[model samples]
Target: MDPREGEFVDRMGLVMERFGGTRTMGRMYAWLMVCDPPHQSLTELAARLGVSKTAVSTVARQLELTGMIERVPTASREHRYQVAAGGWEHVMKVQFAALRQAVETLDLGLAAVGGDRPEQRARLEETRDFFAWTERDADDMLRRWRDSREDLDR
Candidate 1:
């Protein structure tokens, strides 16, 4: 693998790991995102990610089910996986949804467990606040970047 691709794999691995997913899955998804043709056959994805074809198939299917990716129909029998065309938009949307779900889970847990549990509730509150802040900050940054890009284009 190219050095740049390796870096991409590593970075993606960190991102996925931080988000409660496997590092290998991150590398696999990142490879599909940046790879030429923006798609890969199961065999090719396996070779590139240094995993088994079955593993690639499993991961690819999971990603597809989660709307992170999709299958590209081909004349050949083998299936191909690719990053969604909207790319970061799609990925961030999923991430945000997951974050929101986590917050909702925390809410339910807090309600069930009661607010008297100071330590556990503190942790949950911290996590909820962090994700909420991150979501706002990311949205603001993206908006500014888009505005700047639009200005440059004019």
Candidate 2:
């Protein structure tokens, strides 16, 4: 990789780390974003990123689960991966799902704590409200993205 490309990968790693992902995940994502073919085998990714195949595989699975990347089917045994289409919208959808789950968990917690304990109830309520709002906002954002995409396509 060129020095500039390496720097970009490193910066992506830092950004992912800030958001609770491993550096390898970010680097792989960055590479996929700018790679020539836009898809790569695990071995190729590992070699290019200078990481172990196992590490690359693990992060790739994580990214796949999070809707950030996808495993491309191949005739060969070795699977290929690529950045998913509609990347940002997909990410927001995944995040919205997570926030919905959080709200469910928080609701349970609030019920468990009971309304008698004002402080605990208040705290859980506030957190739950935040997640609820975030979920709604994510939905709205995705809707807007779709509208803009349609406009651009037209």
Candidate 3:
């Protein structure tokens, strides 16, 4: 890899680390984003990234699960991967689902706590409301984006 490319990969690694993912995951993503042909086998990824095949495989699986990357269909035994189509939109959807789940959990907590601790209950309620609002806004944003894209394509 060029020095510039290595720096970008390292920066992406830090970004992923901040989001609770391994540095390897970010590096893999960064490499895939810039690589020619936009797809690579596990062995190729490992060799280029200077990581073990096992590590590359593990991160690739995680990225696949999160809808950030996908396995390309091939007749050969070795699997290939590339960044998923609409990956950012998929990530936003995942985040919205998580926010909804958080709201549900907060509702349960509020119910269990009751009015016993007014301050805590208020805080929980506020948090739940925030999540609910954010979820609604995200849904609206996605809908608008789709609508705009359709208009542009027409």
Return the TM-score for each candidate structure: 0.64, 0.81, 0.88
Segments in model 2 whose C-alpha atoms lie over 4 Å from true places: 73-76, 112-116
The 0-to-1 C-alpha lDDT of every candidate, in the order given, reads 0.80, 0.90, 0.93
lDDT of 3 by residue, 50-139 (tens): 999999999999999989999999999999999997777887898788997899999999999998899999999999999999988998
| CA deviation > 4 Å runs, candidate 3 | 147-154
- In terms of lDDT, model 2 sits at 0.90
Better of 1 and 2 by lDDT: 2
Output the lDDT of residue 110, model 2.
94
Q: Which candidate has the highest lDDT of all?
A: 3
> Could you give candidate 2's per-residue lDDT for residues 1-154 as a string of tens digits?
7888999998999999988889999999999988878899999999999999999999999999878899888999999999998766776676678887899999999999997899999999999999998887887888888999899999
TM-score, predicted candidate 1 vs. hidden true structure: 0.64
| Residue range with the least summed lDDT across 10 consecutive positions in model 3 | 85-94
Clashes of 2: 0
Q: In each prediction, how many residue pairs overlap at the backbone (N, C-alpha, C within less than 3 A)?
A: 0, 0, 0
